[model samples]
Target: MVTIHELFQNDGQKSRIGTTYNKILYVPESVLQTIREYLDAQSESEYQGEDNTIIYTAKFPDGREMDIKCCGCQEESSWTEAVLFDEKGYQLTYTDVGEKFEGLWELEYDGIHYCVDVKPERNNSKMED
Candidate 1:
């Protein structure tokens, strides 16, 4: 499952003026594995990273594209967190549907918490609850 690493902090205020803020999530390796397997089953191609991370992307038969990033924390005993995006580069959210490996996530920026939900398995634009 995914958990908040840090909710709010003024760590790097000067550099990230108008761009994205700093937010981190701690996702378990098991969850990462499940996500990777799911992407692989969808025929997504994997991209290697210099660090212990892999990026997967694919354009579905329905013409929508998905991008997923799995990042491993060296200090956290190899646990990984995932960041998902669509073809337009918008961050996907995670929602807790009472499942073992599903949850919701919010990123705080400019004192506002924006919801980020996972893209549904189907090629629909509706957000998950």
Candidate 2:
């Protein structure tokens, strides 16, 4: 172990940390593809979300599964998150492609490809006059 003085004086950012996954999020195939092509063409999607369903795996190409969150958004902006996990259930990486996700985009992590695709449903109610 390095001392506190050595940490500040010398290189202190040389340590590696490990993490664990407590939950898994999944997304639909069509939804994910749309998100992947967002940069190429700006578009909109209408998702259906009346029931609270906890997704376990995503319907992806090559039959590989991943976790993506699908929440309803009836506002100006929404939040989307996609977490990639290995077969052993260890989280490899994640992506936040909603809200202010712009500029140079890195769609791959640990040799795997992924992007942001949050399916937020819109359920409106009319008031009687």
Candidate 3:
């Protein structure tokens, strides 16, 4: 499992926070690979060479999964975890990814942005909060 967090420097104070994956964000396999490479390269450039900065995890199509490590981009607040839903199929989520948001949405990672269209699950529960 990959664990992703966002680190921010606000008013000279360092803060690290978790990202919320409440929407459907999908990208091509190549794009995802590029992201991993970029992070790996950065890690190699660091002076200390400490490899405990960020973590990465993969999500399966099935619903059985657990939280995992994440990358620095996700840890640095550049990217947030999101679920992917098939417009005409079904919605699968794990502990790492957030809720499912359908329709059109945009995502920007490391100065790159992607547009996706998702079909969210239908809500028919009788209880409301």
Candidate 4:
């Protein structure tokens, strides 16, 4: 079994799936704070299984809600996670789905909130030195 610390380390790795963003976005800190607060208030639970991943829930200040889960690794550690968007007509089937939209993707986990700009994950277009 892996601990949370291991997960954070694995998340920091810069392999193929976890490379630098191909794009960036700008949003308000207030909005990001709101999502963080909402996540901080939620109860904790684990989705355990060979294929099942750990999931949690949060409520936005606007009364909106969403779900998040640690993307479990079957063999090697996969830093990607499973996230669900709560807005109407927005159905997310995967974590990378967030890239399609260009706006604020407010999320919270373990009592902390974060705002993700849904732009392309920026990457170096030119060779690095």
Candidate 5:
């Protein structure tokens, strides 16, 4: 099992998909509190949360950069994540899909509240009902 510690590692490793979650889930309570505190400190940071979806620039201590875009946040149901890019925003996609899109993505899934300034898993983008 992938622990919260593993999911939120800040060491610049790209996260891998271990399983598909059936429903929306929050980061473990212990981790949630930590994330909340971290996010609170970055309150001045700006992102797309106001308009439902999220589009923000993320920088890591390891000198990596990427723009994250999360969709379907304003709706009560249905969340769609996008394929994103590295460095400055551009375009990318899973070669298997052949559905090319601009941008590199992050996260085990879409829209995890309190992950405002925290970098998400650089792999595993998806849309779940």
Candidate 6:
């Protein structure tokens, strides 16, 4: 029952706001651990140089299942884009990780903007908005 909020910031005022999409997901802790392990493994490997897609399964509390997909480059670059798709194959979220701002990243999902220090791990951490 973990909740994730999309955060936005005002550059001029340096203020932040959180917007909850009222999205809820019912995912097992084991699944989260698996996702973390997969990402950690990918981070340690050379697969990033090639086009890679990591797929995993998630189930909702009401018994709906989804296939989560993450696509990105594994190269050491100043900037990279990772796109996540929903179970219906719709583009669920877009993330830009670049050196233009060190240790910062931007995310757009469901037509909303979010400023995050770290990329949301998998399929918005298996969230449903």
CA RMSD of each candidate after superposition? 13.7, 15.4, 18.8, 18.3, 16.1, 10.6
10-126: candidate 4 lDDT, tens digit per residue:
668643222111213432345333333333323223212247443334334433344434343334332333354445625443344221133444544433343434322225322
> lDDT, candidate 6, residue 19?
38
For candidate 2, write residues 30-119 as lDDT tens digits. 555544343233323433232432233443332334555433343222344555665666776766654322222224554344433333
Question: Which residue pairs does candidate 5 place in steric collision?
Answer: 84-103, 84-104, 85-103, 85-104, 91-102, 107-121
Q: Please list the C-alpha lDDT of all candidates, in the order they appear.
A: 0.36, 0.38, 0.34, 0.35, 0.31, 0.39
- Which number leads on lDDT? 6
- Checking candidate 4 for backbone clashes, the offending pairs are 21-121, 21-122, 22-121, 22-122, 22-123, 23-121, 23-122, 36-113, 40-111
Per-residue lDDT tens digits for candidate 1, residues 58-122, read 33222233333544332332222333344476655432222122333443333333333343343
Each candidate structure's TM-score, on Cα atoms with residue i matched to residue i, is: 0.28, 0.31, 0.20, 0.29, 0.24, 0.30
Stretches > 4 Å off in candidate 2: 1-56, 59-64, 71-78, 97-107, 115-129
lDDT agreement of model 6 with the native: 0.39
The residue pairs found clashing in candidate 6 are 48-74
Q: Count clashing residue pairs per candidate.
A: 7, 3, 16, 9, 6, 1
Looking at model 1, how many pairs of residues clash?
A: 7
TM-score, model 4 to reference: 0.29
Can you tell me which runs of candidate 3 are displaced by over 4 Å? 1-21, 42-129
Best by TM-score: 2
Q: Tens-digit lDDT track for model 6 on 1-129?
A: 223554455654443344322223334455444444444443435333335544443333322233334333455322334344455656566554322211233444554443323223454463332
**How big is the positional error of residue 75 in model 1, measured in Å on the Cα after superposition?**
12
- Which ten residues in a row are the worst by lDDT in model 5? 94-103
Positional deviation of 65 in candidate 1, in angstroms?
17
